[model samples]
Target: MSEKQETPEQRRERLRQEEGRGNPAGDMNDAANRASNGSLVDLTGSLGWKGTGILALFMVLAFIIYAVFFR
Candidate 1:
């Protein structure tokens, strides 16, 4: 039985072909050209008016506490 081992160049070409087949048109690179694949932080959809008001109140309270105690 005769078995042929792949050369380094042949192996590299094979891997390159596999990568091309895995992601045609090199679109995967384009798609991954970002820090993350998800959207930025946006609470507008999840936070209702009441939630927004509460968040604002918390911020004001935090600022007041920091100023009154730290100053």
Candidate 2:
């Protein structure tokens, strides 16, 4: 009898398949839903609105500053 252990790739593939069968990107989906990936890094749903608002505010503030000081 020959002994052949499962390769790392095989194990990973099996685990991935099981993951798909069970939850289909469950952890990633959960992390995204929970806003766990951070706003600066991913900004997916975590910082979208806030980031946009901040950017708009900064732009308006910069324009006002430039109009007052530079122009």
Model 2's number of clashes is: 0
Q: Pick out the ten consecutive residues of candidate 2 with the lowest summed lDDT.
A: 37-46
Question: What's the C-alpha lDDT at position 36 in model 2?
Answer: 55
What do the candidate models score in CA lDDT, each in turn?
A: 0.62, 0.63
The list of candidate 2 runs beyond 4 A from truth reads 1-47
Estimate, for each residue in 1-71, the C-alpha lDDT of model 2 and write its tens digit.
12258654456556656776777678567557648545333332344677768877988999999999997
lDDT of 1 by residue, 1-71 (tens): 11258754456556666777877768466446423554222242246567768888998999999999999
Instruction: Provide the RMSD of all predictions against the true structure, rounded to 1 decimal.
Output: 17.5, 13.3
> What TM-score does prediction 1 earn?
0.42
lDDT of 1: 0.62
